[model samples]
Target: MTARALRRRAPEPTGSGRGWKEQTRRVSELCLLGIVATVLCLPVLTVGAVVATLSTVVAHWIDHDDLPPLRDMGAEFVRRLAPGAVASAAGGLATLVVVRQVQWLASGAVPGGSPVLVALLAAAAVLLTVVLLAVPRLAGGGTWRTAVTGGWHALLGRPAAGGAALGVTLVAGLLAVLLPGTVLLLPALLVLALHAVHRALVPGAP
Candidate 1:
């Protein structure tokens, strides 16, 4: 074999190495974002704003291939705070009510146990899916009312996409339950999943 022939036979470097490196960097960034979001959510009421901020950050990253500055994220959180708090409170109350009902039903206090329990579970799942689908819309710059309405419509418009979002939420929740430490990353993971699901399911989604 001649030297020239041997050189030509050498395999060209593929982009797989670069792809893996990019994926790793993206994952690291998401982990950091998740930790920051978890800290911001410690106040409880701020959970909604933190989620909106995370969603905005994820959207920016998806569109720009870079994370926005912390200052920008902070500003976004402050802007969303009031409405976010209200929404968070309402959501919390609703969740509590559902949980109580579930507990009551599970304890056999209710007459129609299995059917009622199944209905409640289905409703909860649907609500969770709608909220998951709507988080990405929070980045669209609108009143909370509009964002929520749009999210609901989005779900109606794309039932399959809503199902996919629900699956992602369920998987994320299961992972968080199985690995308590992942709870810290849950917000970021969810925001990223929301973006991925929307972008894949909705054409021209930035």
Candidate 2:
């Protein structure tokens, strides 16, 4: 063979190249899932189920390094419907109570508007962090009790990471409140942030 021919290298296998392609595909899948999740979440009662499914998809991707079929997610969603809806309803009710309390205080019906607002915001941050952890636990095959208690453990064990996740949620919430249109982006951002937090905080989490 000529020197030039000898110098040429054979094409490499596509396995590694496929990784980036795989990641890109996963990202697109996440976005699409987020879109579906956003629509499902509109009813509000399905919020917990949607969040759980989002976390399940994320965990599945992390653990298996593959995209689960949409049908699998759909099946899981169906299975989780009852519990998820119940949880969502409870959470919504609690949130409504908080909102009403906050409004009452702000309207001068009570003595401590500023203090109440600050306290409520802090409470919300903590609650949001717990819920984020809980959903992923459920997605990972944990029961409701495990989801709740494990969430607290995860949050306490990794305060910094938990705080960061809560912070992202808060900022996104504020932006949604202010711009309204930015609410459209909240689902994708929340899922991505919570997935990152789960990877960091959940032992054996994928």
Candidate 3:
């Protein structure tokens, strides 16, 4: 059997356990990273943002072929902003606090490391975890626990694919930092959007 195929068959525990929560947390962390990258790489990420924005429409279109063309998925995003804003603010603050605590604890070992930067990165990680876990729960589709477990299985079972995904995320993040004025952010957004589309379009991506 191919290595990829073997990874696909890893014996991942399904939604029936606490393992799911961890999975959800990581997913949230990943999403948080995307958001940070988008904001940081604003000017250059326009195309990517547009692509990601479009992916939502495409996902719906694929699910319901008879759906109206050009359905304003964009509009719904705007509408949700009010609610998302509250949630995001709360989430961000909590993340920042916890990350700071963690960094302070780590300071004893990492002599000269910047606690602020570490804390910020840690908060981003926590934010990703929280978002992934919380969003799915709020959507009423899956518990944060279920999404985490299922999502991790999706990664663990496909090591190569999972690694590639991390690679894409890292490169996109780098573009956000290195070429803040470039179009890479849009591409990054598209990559994310394409991922969403692919999963939705596929029969059983997860």
Top lDDT prediction, candidate number: 1
Error of model 2, residue 149, in angstroms: 1.6
For residues 41-75, what per-residue lDDT tens digits would candidate 2 score against the true structure?
98898987777777777777666766588799889
Judged by whole-model lDDT over C-alpha atoms, candidate 3 comes out at 0.46
For TM-score, the strongest prediction is 1
Per-residue lDDT tens digits of candidate 3, residues 1-206? 99999999988764445386766664454354345445633443242233333334334433443222334645644444444455445545776777666676566543545665576676565445333322222222233345446545554455444444444556666776887864422442434443553254323662
* lDDT tens per residue, model 1, 1-206: 99999999988754344567777887889888999999988888988888888888888887777789878887898998998899889889999999999999999986779998999999988787778778888885656677677677778888888998888887888999999999887778788988899878855566
lDDT of each: 0.84, 0.75, 0.46
TM value for model 3: 0.42
The runs of at least 3 residues in candidate 3 whose Cα sits more than 4 Å from the true structure, single-residue gaps closed, are: 1-55, 58-71, 109-153, 156-161, 187-203
The order by descending TM-score is 1, 2, 3
Model 2 is weakest, by summed lDDT over 10 consecutive residues, at 9-18
The per-prediction CA RMSD against the true structure, in angstroms, equals 4.0, 3.6, 14.7
Q: Clashes in candidate 2: how many?
A: 0
TM-score of 2: 0.79
